[model samples]
Target: MIALVRHGETDWNAAHLMQGSSDIPLNDTGRQQARDAGDKLAAERDAGEHAWSAVVSSSAIRARETGELIAEKLGVPFIRVYPQWFEQHFGDAEGVPVEEAMRRWPNRDPEGFENDEQARLRALGALEQVAKDFDGRDVIVVAHGTIIRSALMSLTGRELGFLGNATASRLSQGAEGWTVHTFGGETLEDELGEPAAEIVAEVEPA
Candidate 1:
């Protein structure tokens, strides 16, 4: 199983900014969210070692910080910079409203990503490399929403929407390769544990 957590909230995320590959620090609420999630994960591991064999995160400042904090809580080690987990490039839509930008140019990444197909291919290849690095181990991935979403599509045979901010997506060992327990969003733990179809809720910067 993989505990796929997204980085905490950023000012850009709060403002609905579309920051593809643009680094941003977490706002106060984002910090709190990470702390809360970390606490929950810690409580789960109170009995013994965490289920994760290893933890890895995007090298982005926000994601790295989140991964480090969560690892600290889970009693895991190693917080390295991994570029394969970076967010998707939005091209001309770098700092605009994410939804608005998507509406302006909703792309159908049938055989490739939204921008620079070659770069997208490189990113996919790198992701496979990182996954291979964690071969035969359950892992934790702290990354951006785009990366998390993309990974879900790759891991499972399903392509759902982007995750709600700071939410965790879970993939468990299943009859088939892997299965998505939940996408990123509030109420995700319950959703995963119970396997229900509820609307994904957003928890804003508090």
Candidate 2:
């Protein structure tokens, strides 16, 4: 099983800013959230459930710090940093407020912005690589919300809304391909396919 964990919240997150690719450290609440996640994972480990073999993290500072804390709590040996797992680059919108960023770059086409499709592909490829490398072992991945959500969209073709900080999702591989079992602790029962019409309509046009 592969568990994807979004990093703890940062000040930008609280400010409702577009934090794409901006290196920000976790805030006090974020640090506590990381500790809480670690405690939960540690409890599961102690109970002999979901024993994690390794912890992997995005190269970003927030994600790395969260991963380190979880690894320490879970007694995992080391963390592998994967740069490809980095969040989508929001270009000029990087530190801007969310509403303004959306208005300015509705289609995410601002200069230097990473295309949504490309970001999705990168996120999928990174997870696939990790799945292959750690086959048969339960691994934890600490990454950003956008990339993680992008990966889920690639799998389910659904417009899953923003994932909360420190939340986890589970993905598993089978003969067909990768399947999302749970997202933010909610178990998914349907097969992967195009998103619902309402969901598609709700998304702002690029």
Candidate 3:
């Protein structure tokens, strides 16, 4: 099982700014949120509900910080950082207000911006890599909301909207492939069955 956690909120998130690859640190509230999330995970583990084997995070500062806090709380000794898990690069739209960014580049075609398909592919690849690396172990992955949402949408064909800061979404891998379940353990989707190649073919630049 892999639990995908969004990093805690930053000031730019509060301001509704585009923070794609911006390297913003968390605010005080964000730090508290990370600690609170850690506490919750610890409680779940203490109750023998789940045992987290490791905590892996994006190389971004905010995500790293969150993963560190969570790992500490869970008494997990190792934390790995993967650059492939970095948030989607918004290019010229980054660091601007969200509404203004949309108005300026409605199609996201301005130089430096990553298209949706590219972001989705990166997210998928990162998740698949992690699953392979930590086979048969439960892990926590700290990443950005957009990347998590993109991966979920591609796998489930459901637009889950923005994932809340420090919140987790659960995914599991088995012989049939990846299966996504709600945090409550309800089955949301299954039978993904190695769609990476299919996604690559479908989203190829045309």
Candidate 4:
């Protein structure tokens, strides 16, 4: 199982700014959110939800801080960062407000911005690396919302909206391939534990 956790909030996030690749630090509320997320994971672990072997994060400061807080709470090791898991590049619109960017770039794709395909490839690559390095152990991945959403979209073929700060989306490896079990607080399974929808794509480890 790989738990993809969106990093906690930042001032930019509150202001609806496009903070791609900006290296913004988390705010006080963000820190508290990270701790709360850790507590939530711990409680779930106590109930035998899953055993997390390690915690990893993106290279961004917010993600690193979130991973560290969660690691501290879970008593798990904080592993090295993965640059591939960084948020989608917003290009020249990095510091602009999302609405204004959308207006400026009517198609909502700014110059030099990473497209969906590229983001998906990066996300898949990161997951493949983590799976191989962990040797089938469960891991927690602290990353930005955009990249995580791309991964979820690639696997589920559904555009899951923005993931909340410090929230977790779980992906489990199965015979067919990776299956999204939890996403944005919604379960992708029926009461009998069967997947509600078939996975649209299977990612082969590189």
Best by TM-score: 4
Q: TM-score for every candidate vs. truth?
A: 0.74, 0.88, 0.87, 0.92
Q: If ranked by lDDT, best first, what sequence of candidates would result?
A: 4, 2, 3, 1
Please write out the lDDT profile of model 2 over residues 1-206, one tens digit for every residue: 78899999999999999998999999989988988998987887789978787899999999999998888888886558999999999888988999998898878787889988888779878887887788779899999999999888767666577588998888777766666777765555432233332111111111
- Supply the TM-score for candidate 2: 0.88
Which portions of model 1 miss their true places by more than 4 Å? Answer: 47-50, 106-127, 172-176, 185-206
- Kindly report which residue pairs in candidate 1 clash with one another: none
In model 2, which runs have C-alpha deviations exceeding 4 angstroms? 189-206
lDDT of each: 0.66, 0.82, 0.81, 0.87
Q: Compared with the true structure, what per-residue lDDT tens digits does model 1 show for residues 1-206?
A: 56778888889988988777778888888887887777776675675645665668887888888887777777788446678778776667777786787777677232223554444454455555555677656677788877676555554434456576556776554333455566763343353454444332221111
* Model 3 misplacement above 4 A: 183-206
Model 1 residue 95 CA deviation in Å? 0.9
Range of the 10 consecutive residues with the lowest summed lDDT in candidate 2? 197-206
lDDT of 3 by residue, 3-119 (tens): 899999899999999998999999888888888888888887889977887999999999999898888888896568999899999988888899998898888876798889889
- Consecutive 10-residue window with the lowest summed lDDT within model 4: 189-198
Candidate 4 has an lDDT of: 0.87
Which digits, one per residue and each the tens of the lDDT, describe model 4 over residues 1-206?
88999999999999999998899999999999999999998888889988887899999999999999999999999989999999999899999998999889987677888887888898999988888889778899999998998888888876566689999988887677787878865676542255476454589442
